[model samples]
Target chain A: MGDVEETVADVGEFALIRRITGGRPKGAATLLGPGDDAAVLAAPDGRVVACTDVLVEGVHFRFDWSPPTQVGSKAAAVNLADIAAMGATPTGLLVGLACPSTTPASVVDELSAGLAAEAARARVGVVGGDMARSDTFVISVTALGSLDGRAPVTRSGAMPGDVVAVAGKLGWSAAGLAVLGRGFRSPVTVVGAHRVPAPPYAAGPSAALAGATSMIDVSDGLLADLAHIAEASTVAIDLVGGLIPVDQRLIEVASALGADARHWVLTGGEDHALAATFPSASSVPPEFRVIGSVTRGAGVTIDGKAYTGDPGWQHWR
Target chain B: MGDVEETVADVGEFALIRRITGGRPKGAATLLGPGDDAAVLAAPDGRVVACTDVLVEGVHFRFDWSPPTQVGSKAAAVNLADIAAMGATPTGLLVGLACPSTTPASVVDELSAGLAAEAARARVGVVGGDMARSDTFVISVTALGSLDGRAPVTRSGAMPGDVVAVAGKLGWSAAGLAVLGRGFRSPVTVVGAHRVPAPPYAAGPSAALAGATSMIDVSDGLLADLAHIAEASTVAIDLVGGLIPVDQRLIEVASALGADARHWVLTGGEDHALAATFPSASSVPPEFRVIGSVTRGAGVTIDGKAYTGDPGWQHWR
Candidate 1:
């Protein structure tokens, strides 16, 4: 194994655990960190918000497109965004990693670093985790959050006449993905956006505090996820095409790649933007921009009609 | 596609999620169940104990050896046992499942049923989960527990002169694994033990209430797990060989298989029994039987000496 780059098996499970968790700083929400049977976290409001998300290699990410650290960040970001979507701030995270025994130890180290990077960005830590041997690389993350006495903003809470708004970038990830898929990787900002989403975690709780009627994370595309809220709330949502914020940078990249930036903003997923409904325009938070409104109908639409695009182009589904 | 059973891909991701969570009975601890971005569970003590465990198809369990349900149960049981080891009662569970797109939908259904069965056994619920397409089948379960204001029993609190005790059966799973390895599955008792572990969840808090200093769930085998306690507590442990309780049924199984029952008891993995150290023998709870004593030295020993058996037979490591 000399200088040949030791694999996970070479380092052993316990040793690998040490490498993954050692010296990582835990936040105040963490009562007891790693090296115990279980990690104890502060659930200040007497309730814990939990959700799990799994990312499979090749299916969810490609190593050539995103390094281990970015992939790790994406995994943690996805689950942490879920917590935020529930109008809660994340307290801690638990990761379950399974990779082939021959996987380079460096990959695990870099991935752990990436997870810690994102956890730190969210003001938390990887409180606990487990690693195992598998034929494929799979990362499963569980994020826990505290509501701080706020009622969860579920998908079913929006009502007719509520204004729909969003916080965070919309189609940057999709634009970046398109650029990467075309075998060109310039405009590092867009590519970076695709690899690591910067979810507006604070906007969630702020929206809840501002009397948000409903909230969701944009994981399965804007229209698709909006449709979820529409179905759940038994209402219809119609987005103003002009109001959908298409970042200028994305437009430039889209033009260079010969793609429609607006379509990406409408149907591309993985941006992890927070989308919520407010009872009135005045109730909307500063970070959120008004984009649509809810009505007494079913399904999501563009303006007053259904917008049809390439169905097979639904990359996330 | 006619006359063909549906695969998970055929039902789609969101539909499969509904199949996995719909109609499931949520426990009292589950304040909000599935169909949301995250789940909210009651953490009555204002603190939550969490841990994660990953089970890979060929690495942790073989479908040929155990059905999907048992494998699912095993996955949940391992994480729940970790929570219990901390003197906490599990409140809710989140599962992250990844399997091939071609995998049968029925397998996912039965596996979810098995997870629900075990979660029900623990009086908890599978509050939320995520499913994805992967090249390998993987089940990652995270268990959240409530301490109910009790101090968490950790592995680093044992002091010199403490009495060592254990609750629940040992070596049974090992014997069962042995029987299965021989391709002889007649003895349903042993074989089943290998498939599903019955962790003594209540004994953890009972031990803590009885002033037990340290505790750990026996996962890596008796001696190996005790070593974790010894190293963490900075103390030595010596087990009385004669005092070790090898179940008579296990003895019969081992005898019929020409294997040493005591060795299995001493070194078996995955039984999920609770091993604890109390201030004195009198403080040991009714469910626990004293087996040894703590001392002022380092490392774990058997009958005041290091016991060495066949090396490379470590099935778990």
Candidate 2:
């Protein structure tokens, strides 16, 4: 923090907002940006995909474990992943931040920078937001996306005999969390994955274009998220244990910590990897790897048999 | 507060969300409602107006003074007013809620009901939301609106010689606040105004259709919000002291509280009243009462003289 950095109370709400949004660049979809009563976003296809996610201090993140920038990035990533899971191209974002009055203004600035950077990577912009005083930090992000005239790929469209595939890394975030829990700072990649997930932003729209039957993001553990799909599509899914790709680093970290790598791969959440069902294995793009198949039953199984284990993440459990 | 009412922890996150959003009616603009990765909203005009606002416990509201339903209504009111201020037709809303695990599930249901009522009043619906556990209650609402092919009425469009007018009640909320501060429980209307504002939702689009030059909602005091228009438009506003409408009920409440009614009328906020400028007095709609006029200077004046007093509500001040 800089010596000259002031607390949020020292700078009034309007001034603080002005400072945060003042010279920020906007994307093509941003017809009108902040400073106005409301932002105007172009929805050329006559439809917009919208989603919101909230992160509370100590629950979703901790300042001691993750930097302000990483917190902001993770917040953006989670919401953007929802849009991606809908097979839409993210257009813009609106953020609502509540924090203590004693918080330094520099922290907010870093968070804003992080949000902008992640939004840019996803080809979107931070167009509007709200800020308020709170006893603890709370970040709520709403992502707006466009389908570009394509039909949305919902989780209910999967059919029997369809191939199940995934894009982006699996279980990295869960592995990273375990690593962090053990106080191991080395293996920067694993530790960083826990702090800020890198979801495959382009795979969603690509899968939609390639005629994916159903899609979802891996926020909860794979089995838990797949259970949602199975319930929604009224189809059972069978995962091939051998086909599940396990990262070498995750294996190393799990072995060192005496943890089962397969548990993390099967039940890890927050990786934001894109999971989809395709009509055939050949229809799955190179970015996605076939790991399972849709069957005509209920729930999920491993190698055509029920393998009982811990389900994915659930809040307030 | 029933014995059978389960805590949020007992119901769990996913079940809580499903119970909140299940089988609710959707508006015409809601192409796809919740229970998916994202919600789809139709913005047939090819553009969407969006804004967000957050209300935190003990900071924006008090549980002792407000029930969960009132809290939800007020949260929805503020964000809907922002969309109305932009001269757009509000079509949908996305809410993000955070509360303690010990909170009863019935409280959330009541809050959701309140939100639904307010959204219905504004001709919109709650399409999606995120809920999480927090130590304090927090509600973040994002309102989405459509212009319907009309140009947005920005705050910087006011020109000299335009007539300034307002369409909703002023100072009633301030008087109500004073009454609340003085610990008075009677005067149901005033107390109700403070808890749930009745913004002039139709007047914004009406004024836009009537060729209003500039517009804003009275979230801050009349003079303070007008100052914003003045600064943005590079013009001054002069109010006619005798022409300003003062509600008799507000005057009575202020007299009982031994507070200056004029101060509240000019500087009190959270009224959510639509104030705009027209090219001429003849062009002003019947719903609006002319209170002032635009002039070629900076700042605001009353009866051609600058009346200095408290500027208005400033968060974190």
Candidate 3:
């Protein structure tokens, strides 16, 4: 028999919350955690960076493909990525969970464990949360971050002649998704990337400290996100196809699915990689690799040419 | 033709967000509002109060009974009430919306207008939000607040001799719900209270300055919420039935539905009223009225008698 577990209805709301928050360790930023009407978080810099994201079942994840732990981890990662993209250090997280009453208690426990583990990885704390009963599962996370007195690296800061660079791996999440959809036997590393993305959390602040002119997290494909930077900064961005790093596992998965690896590298999203622009290539940190350069124009391009493939992920579409 | 409108799919995600956030007034605490990856809010007191609440379509509200505007207002009110309960001045809100792709663009616009209107009432800004496509509608709001250097009032701070007081009307929401369910033509004041509660946003800080030992927002009935205070503070609370405030409209609606107004007053949830404990009745501010007193024991009693009705709203139940 599998592990025995009770439903949320059996334990009730307050008891379930107690079970979720019982022994969790809080960070210094969390002056007061759960059990209060509202959690108090220390914002020593006098300014707080806040962002929110929601994941709906069937649209964002499938229970058959992603376990509760992965769902929670993905939710936390995406929200944290937004904070990081703003060149802020994440401090606290508030989660709103909606699930069926018949959901197993172990699912909630595992989900909370995953969320706390991810937050701990970034040295942040889960401060407060709300839970309710719904027909399908939904995970909504809001992350609070501190800028530490540094000027926020906005997308509007990039200027022509700035060098474009990236700090983390890309294409793996989309490649992983493709492999899974095609029922291809692939490496666990590639498959896991789709279920739970590992974002470059520290790279955001590092890029800001290194004098990044502009920055954004690669959630929607590289070109799609860069287009936002280009529009906001009012400058064109040109990526060198050979300079952009591609993982070997992603290449293997793409090949197995008979899909173009370059397509995934250019348009695949959900990797949450950090992309930024600097005044010069020399100013780019050791962790970041120069992929392209900014130019005086509009929109993003690859090797001085427009991308003719599907742009990126659109929620409504 | 009743006002032609475009669907979310026609406008797309980015355009829909722009339509919702464009031309909105920002409050003083909003350093950087929507459009960026994240919003920046000032936390001048070095601490920020954070809370979250989720409202599912059928469980929280019905479109047949309440308009989209009322849904938005209710969502903002409940979350803002949590911040007020902490004796903090609310500064900003982050919303996450999930609805079907077929939803009209005007519906989203109306919802945003409702949220912005309610936020403006408290001098707070609707800073940022995330939207996704789902089969059913869901609205999740996270509120951020500042203590402005004042100490936060917690539920565990109640002393044995503390006098219990409340600063807002009660039982109107529950009575209104009963009246609506019974198809009784009740006063709009009673019915509107259920659709969108008017929480006393200012009385929280006033009570804190008057030395309120402990405070809570009456979201889950007076007895249930006070029981939370009693458990947290490890003390017994005796509420005086005669001292509890009952609105005339609430009584009329209760009588029309053949229900007991006293029962509704004792067990009604979602009133968003401020309930607190002070050192003495005289310490309570003019906005607040004395309702009971804390004692040395455990559990909450009404005039020294144990209540035997349903405890309160249990989400899972």
Candidate 4:
């Protein structure tokens, strides 16, 4: 007989839970982990930061483009970045996954491994989860965080004169998506960036400590997310085109594809870079670079003019 | 034009979010609510209790049988029950909702209303949530709770000499399901039980305060879930059949349907009743009634014999 591949139906529900959670390493904050009805985690700051993000199969991702492992890690990364944007340290993640029973057990295994790997990187645990059957595959992850006694830097805190800086890679995922859309995956770096995002998790709390006025996770394009801060804080922002750094790698890929690199840098989404407003340029951390300043007008602008590029990947639009 | 029915797409993602969360009441623990990247909730006890539960459109509930509001409340009830099972009081909830773009905005609004009504009853809030578009409708709720300095009562704490008891309704949801399956809806009580469970939220912490050894939320029938506690605690339990209470309403419905009410009482799921083990009968709280005794064996027994009835509605099977 050829190697017999097992599906989730073959193993049943409780056994699958045991397989997913058994022998998984625990994080520092996991007072109680899976196998019980609920999990307990240390909050430390007398408060907890929480957020949720959902990924659907055909809409949010495709198996042909990315493996199940990358999908799982992407799920964890996206939700954890929300905690970071709140200027908090994540403690654990709870995943609610629904998929067809006909799906191979290997897919679920690899996906769980990916989630574990990302949680490990963030020094947190996949503390709890639920599994169900559905025609459409959906993974919902909720991230819980501890603020470590630092006040949350909200989007409404930005002042007119505050400096806008960003920490981590920008437009990498968008460029990678462009490459994949063109049916080319030769550039491993760009392709891999699309499959997985490395959000700057630590810079959030560091920026909070350095007197950040406002912050956001750039998952809906840099300019669009900045517009969110502007609307919430009732202030305007202006960015110098020269000050906005477009990486050489992205520029090369854009040139090959006959696309505008500057547009991608300004309006691309899903890189999960951290954007924050500092009181002054001196207060900006080394991880972040000043790209603009909050101004006394209405919305985000390029130097003085409105950026008229395509608003790429606003998410759910 | 006949008043155009608004779909989620017509309302757009941001507008739908505002309609779902705007002006909704805040809970006692809600330090920060929706519209932020993440919500902040008071942990109070230096630690937080958490759990997640996912409900799919066809797999978990049907719109024809239960209204959208009930589905929403059911989602909240199930996740909040998990927190109560941990001997903690829930502080707030984070929801991740995925549905088709064509879904009615009114359906979304009523569902949000259901979630809010239940949260208000539990003295918590729908603190934050995410909205996404998909072919199937899925609701994933994460409940966070505080222990109030009480030690968590895990399933493994049942001892051989402990007294077993239960709080809240049993077999009501199952009877309701059976009633609905037979094409009858007169018994609104039973049908409503299936749609929204009134899980004894306060009884859990009370059980822990009464020095209860172990506890669980019974969403998988009495025997099946008791088997979990038995396996986790490495001990058997024997229930006195005379002590088991089958509601008069259930008996009335079962008699008319020519079904066995006892079997329903034994193996019915989704009533979300709380079960616990105490050192003695006197230690059991007023909310609970003594039904069995823990023994030095491995599984659950009904009047010292193995129950051979049908195991109804095991989730994800």
lDDT scores for all predictions? 0.90, 0.89, 0.88, 0.89
Q: Number of the top candidate by lDDT?
A: 1
Model 1 shows how many backbone clashes? 0
Report the lDDT tens digits of candidate 3 across residue range B45-122: 888999999999888887766778887888999999999999998999999988889898888888888888889888
Candidate 2 displacement at residue B123 in angstroms: 1.8
Collision pairs in model 4: none
Q: Which should have the higher lDDT, number 1 or number 2?
A: 1
Interface RMSD of 1: 2.0
Residue A109 local lDDT, model 3: 91
Better of 1 and 3 by DockQ: 3
Q: Write the residue-wise lDDT of candidate 1 on A1-317 in tens digits.
A: 45798889888887787777667879779998988899999999999999999999998899999999999999999999999999999999999999989899999999999999999999998988888888899999999999999999999999999999999989888888998999988789999999999999999999999999999999988988999999999999999988989888888887887889988898888999999999999999999999999999899988898979743223224
Top DockQ hit:
2
Candidate 3 TM-score to native: 0.98
Give TM-scores for every candidate, taking all chains together and pairing residue i with residue i. Answer: 0.98, 0.98, 0.98, 0.98
Give the least accurate 10-residue stretch of model 4 chain A, judged by summed lDDT.
A14-23
Clashes of each: 0, 0, 0, 0
* Candidate 4 runs further than 4 Å off: A1-4
Which residue window of length 10 is worst by lDDT in model 3 chain A?
A16-25
Pairs with steric clashes in candidate 3: none
The docking quality of candidate 2, as DockQ, is 0.88
